[model samples]
Target: MRFGMALPGPNVAAVDCLPLDVLPLILEHLTDRRDLHTCAQLSKAFHNAATPLLYRTLDVRVTMYTGMQRAIVLHPSTTILQRPEYAKYVRHVRENGAVGFHRPDLMDDCRKALKMCVNLEGFTWSDDSAEGTDEGDFMRYLDILQTLPLRELVIQTFYGLSDSVWAKLQDFSGLTKVSIWCMEGKPRILQGWSEKLGASLTHLELGVSSLSRAPHPLYFLSHLPRLRALRLKGAPSAAILEILTFLPQLETLDTEYFGAALTRYDDVPAANLRHLTVRTSSVHIQGFQQLWPWIRRLTPRPSLESFTLNAFSTQGEALVPRSFILDMAATHKDTLKRFKADSTQMTLKDIECMCTVFPNLESLSCTTMWSPESAPYEEAVQKANKLRELRLNLHDWRPTHVRLAGLNNANIEVAVRNMMLREGAALRLVGIGSIVYRGQWIYKKAEDGSDKVEFEITSNVIKDVWD
Candidate 1:
C-alpha cells in the first residue's frame, strides 16, 4: 500500500523491518554464484556480503591467465598479500601451460602469486614443453615457492632438475605433500631431495623416465620418519627398500617398475602400510620369491587393502603363477579388498586360485591367459560369493571357419546345441565378431536356406572352450 510499509499490523512501520537474524536465512537461497552476482549488483549491502564468497577461490589455470590478469586489474585495491585469510581461501592453483607462458613469465607470475597467498596451502604447475637449460630459473621458482604458506606443491615439467632444487625446497617448513615429474633421466634428483625433505614430509611422488645402475639415489630417503605415502617411477629396488626402511608410518606405496632386483624387506620394520601397487615391464619368478620373505614378516602386519601386479612380457607368456598371488591373498585375507593382475600369459586357473585366497575381496580384475577347463570356473564362482566385480580375458582368439565331415542338419543342430549348452550358463555377455560381437547376435540362415553360422566369441569363452 505504501513504500516499505505493511497494510495491517500493530505498528506498520516497525513490522516492515524484519529481524537481522532473518536476513541470513533469506540470503541462504541466494548463495549460488549467478544469484549472488545478481544480488550484489542490486545493492551495496548485498555486494559487501557477497564479495567474500566471490573472491574466495582464485583458480589460475595456464589457459585462464587472461581471466586472472583481468581480475588483478579490476580488483587492484584488493591486496591478497595483506589479508591474513588469503591462505585459507586460496586452496589450489593449477598452472598447466597452453598459455605460452614460458619460464620467465611463469617465474614472475609465481613470485607475485606466492607473495599474496600468505596462507596458501596447495600449488600445482605443469610445463610440458622441453626447454630451459640452467638450474637458475628452477632455483628461483623453488625459492619463491618455499616462502609461500604451502602445505602441498606439485611440479610437472619436462626439464630435469638438479640436486640444488632440494636445498631450495628446505625453506618450506610446512610442506606436507609434493609431486614431481621429471621427463628425462633417472630420478637421481632423489639422492639429495629425500635428505632435505627429512622427517617432516608426509606425502611424496616422483616420476622419472629412467633408473640408474647405481643405488645411492635411494639412500637419501632413509631419513623421512613421518613419511606416509610414497609413489615412484623408474626407481631401483635397492632405493625402494632403503626408502621403505625410513617410512615407518607409510600407508601407501606405488611403484611404476618392479625394479631390476626383487624387493628384500626382511630387515625393515613392520610399517603401518596397507596398500601396495607395482607395475613393471617384466618380473622374474626369482624376484617374487625374494619379496616373499619380507611379505611374510610384517610384524604389525598391515591389512593389505589393495594389490596390483602389472607385468609385461615379450615372450607372450606371463611367468608369475597364480600361487604367488594366492599367497598374498591368504596372508592378508581379512583386509584385502581389491586385487588386479594384468599379463599376457597368466591363466584363469591362476585367477581362480587368487579368488579363493581372498574370500572377502570386493573387486577382482585381470587380463591374462584364460583356460576355462584348468580354471575350475564353476568352483570359483561358487567360492567367490563375496566378489562384487569380476573381469577376465582370454589370451588369443581369431576367426576361422570349420567344415564338418558329417554335413547334415542333425549334425549342425547337435553341435550348435552342445556349444550353447556348455557355454551359455557361464557367459552372460559375449563378444564374437568385431562389430557384431559387441552387440548380441543370433545365428541366421542364408537366403538359399543353407546353414551359414557366423559369430564372434569373447576371450572368456575362447578360454573355456579351449581349456
Candidate 2:
C-alpha cells in the first residue's frame, strides 16, 4: 500500500503499490479525459502521470452549438500561456481558425503558445467560418509552427487558400502527412508543394469535395513515391488505378469515383494495395454499370485486403452488381477481410457470394431488401464462419424513419438470435434495419468433460469500437 494514500482506504487499494513507471501505463487505458483530469488532481504522482496525457493532444474546435452561447468561454490556448510547464507536453494541436479569428487576445495567446510547444509533432488549422481569413492572421500562426518539430499538417479552409498560402506551404519539406480539404475551390495539383514534400510525405489527402469536375488525382499524387495512404475526393474513377503504377509503395487509397468510363489505365499492373475505398453518386443505373468495370480492373491487384464503396444519390437504386462481387471473389477472395457497401443493395445471392467466397471476412455491411416471406438468411449465416460483424440497411421501411416499419425490436432480436446460434458461428455483432445487436458466446464445461456454448444477444444502441 505504498502509493495507496490517494484513495479513501489504503488497505483496500493495495494494488496502488504498482511501480511509478507502471502507473502511467495503467492510466493509458482510461479513455475519458474527464476521468484523467480527476485523477490528475488526486495526488502529485497521479498529476505527473496524467498531466502529460491531458496535454499531449489539444483540440480547440468551436462546435456548432457554441455559436449560440452568450458567455465568452476561455480558450485552451490561453491556458498553455498561463501554465507554460504544460506546453512542452503538447505533441499535437488541432485548432479551428474561427475559434480565435474575432478575438485578438486568444489569437495572440495561441501564437505565443505555439512557440513554447517545441515538441509538437502535428498541427491542424481549419476555418469553417463563412467569412474569409486574412492572410496576415493565418501567416502569424504558420510562422510559429515552422519553428516546431511538426511532421503532420492538415489545412481545411472553406474559403480556398490563396496563392501566397500555397507558396508558404512549400517550405514544409520535413512533413510526412498532409491533408488539404478545400470546399469551395477548383481542385488542382499543388505540384510545387508535392515536389517539396514528396521525399518525406507518406500520407496525403486532397479534396475538391463536390459531385463533378474533380481533377484527375494522379496529377497531384504521382510525385510522392513514399506514400502509404492517400485520400482524394472528386477524382475521376477511371484514372485512380493509374496512380498505383507510379507509386509502387502506396497501400491505402480513398477517392471519389465519378463513374467515368474506363478509357485509359487499362494496363495497370499488380499492386500491393491493402485498402481501397471509393465514393460516388449517380442518378441512373448506367453510373453503376461504369462502376463495375472500374472495379473489375482491380482483378490484377490480388493483395487487396479491404474494399469500401460509398454511393450517394437523390433517386435511383444503389446496387452492387453481382459481377462486381464475383470479380472481387476472383482476385481478392482470400485476402479481403472487410467489405462495406452499406449504401448499396445486395441480394441474398450477393450476400451468399460474399460469405462463401471470402472465408476470411471479418466484417460485412450492405443494404438488403428484406421481407418476412423472403428465404431465411441461412446461406450467409452458415458460410460466414469467420465473420465477426454484419451491418444491414433493410430497405423494407422508409429511410427517413429510425427503425424499420415492418420489423419490430422483437423481430430483430429473434433474427439476431437465430444467426448467433448457428454452428461454429464467430459472429459477434449485427446491425439490421438501422438497429444494432451485440452477441456474446457463453461457454461452459459439460458434464461429460466437453464444452457447451450458449448465445446471449442484446440490442446495443451504442456502437462498439470496431463498428
In model 2, where is the ten-residue run with the lowest total lDDT?
458-467
Pairs of residues at least 3 apart in sequence or in different chains that clash in candidate 1 = 87-119, 318-345, 346-369, 432-456, 432-457, 433-456
Lowest-scoring 10 consecutive residues by lDDT in candidate 1? Answer: 430-439
Model 1: per-residue Cα lDDT over 1-467, one tens digit each: 22222134444335335564554455555536676565455444444544555555554443335546531212211345445454445555554443334323345544565556655577776666676334565565566666666778887778655556655655566568878787864454445455556756899887764244335556556767788888888676555665665667888888754534545554655465688877665434444444443344432364678877666655454555555665666568778878766453445566566656777776666665423232344444345546555555445453222211122224323332333334422222322211111212457789999877665432322322222
Indicate which candidate wins on lDDT: 2
Candidate 1 error regions (>4 Å): 1-88, 96-115, 133-144, 162-166, 185-196, 209-215, 256-269, 283-302, 344-346, 368-379, 397-467
Each prediction's TM-score versus the true structure: 0.60, 0.86
For all candidates in order, the CA lDDT equals 0.54, 0.75
Candidate 1, residue 339: lDDT: 72
State in Å the error of residue 176, model 1. Answer: 1.1
lDDT at residue 55 of model 2 (Cα atoms): 94
| TM match of model 1 to true structure | 0.60
- Measured with C-alpha atoms, the lDDT of residue 457 in candidate 2 is 75
